[model samples]
Target: MTSVWDLPDFDDHEVVHFVHDRISGLSAIIALHSTALGPGAGGTRFWHYAHREHAVTDALRLSRGMSYKNAMAGLPMGGGKAVILADENGTKTPEMLAAFGDAIEGLGGRYVTAEDVGITDADMVAVSQRTRYVSGLPVSDASSAGGDPGPFTSHGVYLGVKAAVAEGLKTDSVRDVRIAIQGVGSVGSGLARLLTADGAKLVLADVNNDRAAALAEELGAEHVASDAIMGVDADVFSPNALGAILDEKTIPGLKPKIIAGGANNQLAKAEHAQLLHRQGIVYAPDYVINAGGIISVALEYLAQRDGEPCSREQVMERVGRIPERLKAIWQESAERDMPAANVADAMAQKRIGRA
Candidate 1:
């Protein structure tokens, strides 16, 4: 078993717990980065990592990112993240979800879990049965405030893309613009629909060929091989699948002038932000652009606390601020000649009193 002390230069997390249940073949990590704003709240990612240490690393990094994300989105929540180590192709039963929920319940509300990556709203529903500290369950229940946050997240990404278009291409509309989307999952599909409605030309790619093909046919988009999507000569490259796609190797192959997507931590390393900046590519900070989900979910959490439920209008009003936030970050980047990632980090630090 790898211990926290064995990790090098790990962030100072408020709490870190390792959970295991041999009976259910469950192995997990929970990391809480902060609680200065409020209880730690973030999503739970279920992925079969190559090693235990890798899962631990992901939890720490994702939790820390959540702290910055929450602060940037003006939410009264800190950062926490959970990861369940399991084979991506393996079965994910309600029993496994309940066990994970039990682990979260042990935290006594210090950490809350939502849906991410392999986790789904149904999984969250299973988790909620074991612990009240879970969100993203089915929103049909009058007593529970949970739902798929993809549309809101994609909405913010859509607005952020337009802001990037204005700054990078000096255009007022995405109509006639070429956008290459690297994923066709929930968030990516939502973004594609919005851009398609606005008359943007789309090139889509995904590992799930059937889904991608159907979406492309529906939207009149051109489909490309998953590996070749990065090299497509589009005005924008939107990576919604996974993180670390903007590293050195792929950066050289990128043909887009704008990098904006719903993926968290799009840059492989913090320094990649500067590399993109030096390359004259407008890289909207991923955390800033992908905040709509958290904003919507956080409002739900807040409403739950106040014994009330937030309306769709109220939630969207807050999510709509993402573009304004991105514009502010862009202005700061221009004035300081700094990368938007750095500007966003500095802004988050200032909000969290680290500046």
Candidate 2:
């Protein structure tokens, strides 16, 4: 097995903690990529990786992404992530949650966790019983900024897609424009509904066939097989799925003029950004467009820590700036003949004192 330090994704991570609780059958990895700006704040993902090493790699990549994401979003928090290793059956229990919570408590506030894939706000509530360093708890009022971060993320991506259309297609209107969306999960579905209301032609795909079919039917859009989505001729291809999907094997076949979505770590490697640029596709850095969720949760945590109120409207106001940041990156990319991902990375690195 390759050592963690030798992994390509390991980018000078400050801490990588492996956790095990035999009694609760809990096994996890908590990674802190940086604490230069503030405490490491990110989400917890509960996933079943075929290999334990894959979990470590994911923790490394995701935690680093969170660092960049938070810095670019102008948040005071740094970056960290926790990945709970699930069994083959994807079993999760209260005991496992409690044990994970205890482990987080042991971190002494250096890391704060919320919700991510296979994790829920309710699970955060459970985790909070063991530690004060948590966010994404269920808010009693809908006007509050803290809760499920999905809708916030969707809103930011929707705005980014519109920005991409304006930049690449030279039009502000999405009406009658074709958009092929991959992964009709919470974020994708929310983006689809928003675009549909704007009269954008939609093609939806997801690994969940039933969900995709139903969303297409409801939105009066078209549905395609997950594998066929990239090949669909559309003005935009929005990937809301897992990371590393935009690698060499897949980028050449993509027919969209613009690639923008809420998926984190979309590029398999740094060079793929140039690949997309060479293909003349306008790319939105995933962390920039997807910072809405983290912004909401981070603000919630900060507000709670300071005993202040954070409103949903304030969160929306912050999220509304996502498109502007993306536009700036795009502008710099064009001026310098650089990929937008590279531009965004340089800016984030400078902000985090990494440059």
Candidate 3:
């Protein structure tokens, strides 16, 4: 906590740029974990952290996750992430967006920015006005591979959950399978809809009570308090919210046979992977399963850079491979008597030239 190098989440980051613009009230941390593969590519998160240290931790952890995510997803991009520290009121302005974009521009293509939690495509547009190193922009056509990456993320997660069900339960169908989802936001809600259509019974929870209730009512699913989601008796517990929820304090209470979702850094620490393995739970490594969004945006960015058009079909083709990667991770986990998360980390590390 005293020095960034001493922080537990700091994973030998390539560059950690701290930006402070008083006139625009922009305070941000941009952490590039790796650029060995290509430019560090990831999204920008706008969130209110109670403490500055927590914000730094998030930036560090998320940037490292992005590196693994991009590497595992087979993208030329490496990994990086940006965090804009919001105040208690979560105030955001155009000036802040422009300044943030300027900061990204100053990186000189080493980093590319997109949209993440609490950041919308429109916000990315504002950020784009100042920098060409921005993506997740609204597209002119629905068939184009550019826009909010939420649906792409949800699609990959949905496929990953299905893969988990097949691997752990020895069944290819999700029909009547019980799934408890933590966080009914954009990604989670899209996942719920997909699973609902496939005849899966879902238990939904989110910090926004009303949103959870509405989605549950619409899907004919059950709703629970966010804190109580982990204890839900279900076939799979999908965490689509924040990270570090699966630690010593929560893993023992997990009632699911499989854990799969789009949340980044689901494990609080590296050792926690073994705890889940000891519990006999099949885990779909978060980065491996949640690479859909980055795949979409990375492809879009590459296409734009090369003066080519990116199609939705191309993105879907890459996303459809998520299940295959999860299958490989789970297989290695079983063969090596290792946690799936650890196996995934090893694979990703090799991909990023860290191993």
Candidate 4:
């Protein structure tokens, strides 16, 4: 579960902590790849790990991925990831997120925080109480922002997916193409709307039944069990729920020609990309395809700190590049008989290389 990187050339990342009531559960890491560009920015993920090393591994992997994501998305910030070790099933208290906010404050302006998995706008507000080192909070007359980026994230992913579909459906159009979406959260729901508007049919499922059914009803799509989504005869498989879904065993069961979703780190291992390629499935690397939310935040940050007002159009214009990026990656992988993940990794790394 550890990344095998000879990062001897790179400086070791900084680790920080915030404890409350003698509870050290609110731990976080702030990795600065290059602040010569701007502040290190990324999201805070609250996860329940079996061991401390697992959490470390998650933080390292996510931080590195954020670096690549920012570079590819043309953002001015370096990468970082904050992880709070606690059970998501209500075991962690608001104090834990607030304490984590204190840790972000400790970073001063070195890092700016935002929402990620297992954290919400409310959680960001709690953190804002402790530090101005966070974004994605409530809006006011004094401030230009505060709201959920779910819809925007979904919009970018939807655009990326549409690009994938058009390329995927050269033999056919996406009209009535059955797409299986594996999460009905903000991202997935927004994707469903885009698909429906484009006359695409969706087979939707979520661990959250209420939201899933609501989305399905809105789009006139079918609802299936979350586990059943993999084999649902879908033309495009969207995994908006979780990551590492394209492993060895599940690849054989997937009934999709193209795979594109907002989940980070879709491959269980780098080799899984090879397996998917061998299976003839066109897979979009998560980092390349899911850069929408972070890109949006990056634009806002750059605008505020450096007088770079990234308009909504300019922000979305970056999203438009995702399709072209995917097409190039798929073409290169096919021409070279390489893994798409490697292609994406190389593409993303080139951006970091420039930095």
Candidate 5:
């Protein structure tokens, strides 16, 4: 079955399609964005789903968010997302990836897929056998440049947090800011490193105590239990964990002056942005702030397809623009006295109009 979430003003569609497999009870969710600006390019994620409804919801929301993220980041690519439900830990197995690859191959080029949260470069290599619609995957040693894009994402978020803090705290530097980060995953760990380098005092928490402790030690940060992060007195609250963490229950308990993070879809709903607004927390829209990975991958995909090589320098400069783009959103939100989410939506809509 397919469900469509139409962004009427933007003339784009987040098409949610589901595939329920007989074997493994594997359900695949595909979100197709048809050329809001250009090709609908995104990555494929494979995960173990507790429920089919959850997968569909994630696909639809992620697809729409990607559209906004791409449009706001000034990328020609539109947005799409694919999810393959399998084991609890996401399949690294060739067989599972092959099945997931087949699902993407069916989408044609309207949705150019790439490496996402659960998928890897090697997995992209597996998908490449099925379709040419995949990106963020280097095909060879010369092109052998595809892997974790987490660091760049963290860098962008770091800059984004800096911008949010500067504007929210009325301070030019992020130095001395107390930042409590939930999640010590790839993106979160990288963000912690950057924040530490910027002289911010850190409080770290993650579900995985080993990783949390490792990262805390690396950054010389203090550690806290994951759920206790919201109560931590801090200048910046970064939710680098899963989405929906900023819902009504959590937002009201937030003590940060500025809220920024690498997590996708930090707000559970549009109203949460207003809640953050009411609390005087400068909420950097997740889509706008954490677009660095997609941007880097898409550019590389374009280069490889067009016979041009992707350079690290160009990608870094592009990633660096995240702060500027976010600053634009922040300023617009302030001037309009609206939620940052609205400003982000408006920015995306404007791009679609231009197209």
Candidate 6:
């Protein structure tokens, strides 16, 4: 068990809350990395971890990323994240969600929670019953509501891929470019549809073979085993699943010329960015490209504050800027001879008044 005082480098973080509800078996950590930009806003990720330490690490890393993501996207928000230690059986109940929501409410709006991996719109709805400091709820008549952020997130990533391809491959289009996608969850599936419609040849993989097979058939693309995905000789490799994919074991064999996806913390460590650059691969920082969901939810949060409904078109318009931001980062990377990840971090730090 980790205590807030014992957390590594706690001076750099603004707040960290360890929450537990015995009755509902809710164990969660809420990490607020910063509030310099605004109130901390990020998603609640539900996953089963072998040790509580892993969950704590994930919450810290992801919350800091959220802070950077918000700053880089020019949103008036700070970075925060929540992680729920769940059962492997996927038996999340409404009572557990309510308990988590209560924990979030206790923060007094310093942090806002949304849906992330292993979380859904329904889950957010349940969370909202106990706290207003939640986003990504289905649209309702009572107030401006937010729903699943997957499509918007996917759209942002698709645009980022275009920018990366143009700079990395010197191409204007994804059409006919072989793209390998890992994870066919909501965001990945949405990206597959967009890329296929744009004529990109796809190779897909998912732990859930049925999900992968279904998307492959829908896009008329090839399917590979999840473990074999990193080895595919594709023009671009998009990891839409969990973090730490671009780590030591997988980096050596990763055959893609470009790395751009919706996953947060794609790099196993900061050093992996240099490794990618050394390999002549263009690496789009995951947080920069994946800010679409937060951008949408942030708008929703504003609308709720103003007692108005969120506009999808308005959200998409803001999401469209992701490519422009990525293009600037890629250019800076070239001019400075730095990894794109480093460039992105610099950009974010500058925006957040940390540079």
**Model 4 lDDT per residue over 1-355, tens place:** 3342433213354443323345745555455544434577788887777786666666666776777777767777777777777754646677776677677777778888788888888888888898877766655532342356566678778877877787677743567888999998878888888888888888999998888888888779999988888889978999998776888899988889899999887877777888888888888788788887887677666666666545666667776777777788889998999988888788766666642
Output the TM-score of candidate 2: 0.99
Query: Model 3, range 1-355, lDDT digits (tens) per residue?
Result: 4899999888999999999999999999999999999999999999999999999999999989999999999999989999999999999999999999999999999999999999999999999999999888999899999999999999999999999999999999999999999999999999999999999999999999999999999999999998899999999999999999999999998889899999999999899999999999999999989899999999999999999988999999999999999988888899999999999999999999999
| Residue-wise C-alpha lDDT for candidate 5, range 1-355, written one tens digit per residue | 3334433222345455666655635567787655667777777777677876677777777777778788888888887888877676554566556666677677666788877776677778887787777777653443333455666688888989998888888888878899999888878998999889989999999988788888888789999888788899998999887788888888888778888998887777777788888787788889888888888777877887788877777778888898888788778888889888878887787787633
Q: For model 4, which pairs clash?
A: 137-146, 303-308
Query: 283-330 in candidate 1: lDDT tens per residue?
Result: 889888998888877888778877886777787888889888988998
lDDT string for model 6 (1-355, tens) is: 6665576634377888989999998999999999999999999999999988888888998999999999988889999999999887977988899899899999999998899998988889889999999887787543333678878899999999888899889989989999999999989999999999999999999999889998899889999999899999999999999989887778889888899999888998888899898888898899999889999889989788778766788888899999999989888889989999999988888887788
lDDT of each: 0.87, 0.95, 0.95, 0.75, 0.78, 0.89
Model 1 quality (TM-score): 0.95
Error of 5 at 39 (Å): 2.0
User: Which ranges of candidate 5 are over 4 A from the true structure?
Assistant: 1-14, 20-26, 89-92, 138-146, 353-355
Candidate 1 whole-model C-alpha lDDT, 0 to 1: 0.87
Per-residue alpha-carbon lDDT of candidate 2 for residues 1-355, written as tens digits (9 for 90 to 100): 8999999999999999999999999999999999999999989999999999999999999999999999999999999999999999999999999999999999999999999999988888999999899998998899988999989999999999999999999999999999999998889999999999999999999999899999999999999999899899999999998989999999999889899999989999999999999999999999999998999999999999999999999999999999999999999999999999999999999999999
Where does the lowest 10-residue lDDT sum fall in candidate 1?
137-146
Cα distance off (Å), candidate 1, residue 22: 2.0
Model 2 residue 146 distance off true place after TM-score fit, in angstroms: 0.7
TM-score of 5: 0.91
lDDT of 6 at 152: 81
RMSD of 4: 3.5
Q: What is the lDDT of residue 254 in candidate 1?
A: 76
Residue ranges of candidate 2 with Cα displaced over 4 Å: none
How well does candidate 3 match the true structure in TM-score terms? 0.99
| Model 3: lowest-lDDT 10 consecutive positions | 1-10
